[model samples]
Target: MIFTGSLNAQGFEGWFNKYLLPSLTRASVLIMDNAPIHRKSAISQLVEHTEHQIVFLPKYSPDLNDIEHDFSALKRKRMYASSDTSLDDIIRDYCIT
Candidate 1:
């Protein structure tokens, strides 16, 4: 689930608990960027008690992440779209294929 509120550590913790934890089926590695929220003490403790592992990307190396390319492609597709376009419509159009 996409969280639409604060992007702080607390928000991340809630999202991790409500969404991520329940989706896992077995021990796995989760790769994430070096964001402060991802490295919070609460998140560390949570992960330590779970059957999952969290690995952070090297700092200053966003180019190694593929999500950036996905977002860039999405932005490029909507470059000429009207500013009034609804987000739902945009998501449907971009993701429906």
Candidate 2:
């Protein structure tokens, strides 16, 4: 899921169709932040056409986004982690079962 450059609407469209859509095991909610690319009319149309639902988080509401807490913890861990520690290890440590 890492891209070399900033994501534009077209790139997101391709990724959504090629990757995200195919990975769904069942109908689910795809919650996203209020990024411009995520707000595209085409993106909404694509999701609406599927059984899955898409929801955008309220603007400036990091407390409502669970990932924000994980990211904050990750940053704290990264700050103290040894140089030899791998990112995968850090993420695995913080991963919820």
What does the lDDT come to for candidate 2? Answer: 0.85
Model 2 clashing residue pairs (backbone): none
Q: Report the C-alpha lDDT of model 2 over 1-97, residue by residue, as the tens digit.
A: 7779788878888899889988999999988887888755777788877899988777887898899998999999988999999999999987852
Score each candidate by Cα lDDT.
0.78, 0.85
- Residue 77 displacement (Å), model 1: 30
- Candidate 1 runs further than 4 Å off: 61-97
Candidate 2 residues lying further than 4 Å off, grouped into runs, are 61-97
User: How do all models score by TM-score?
Assistant: 0.52, 0.55
lDDT of 1 by residue, 1-97 (tens): 5547669877788888888888999998988787888864677677888889878767875588888877786787677679898767776887886
Error of 1 at 33 (Å): 0.7
Worst 10 residues of 2 by lDDT: 34-43
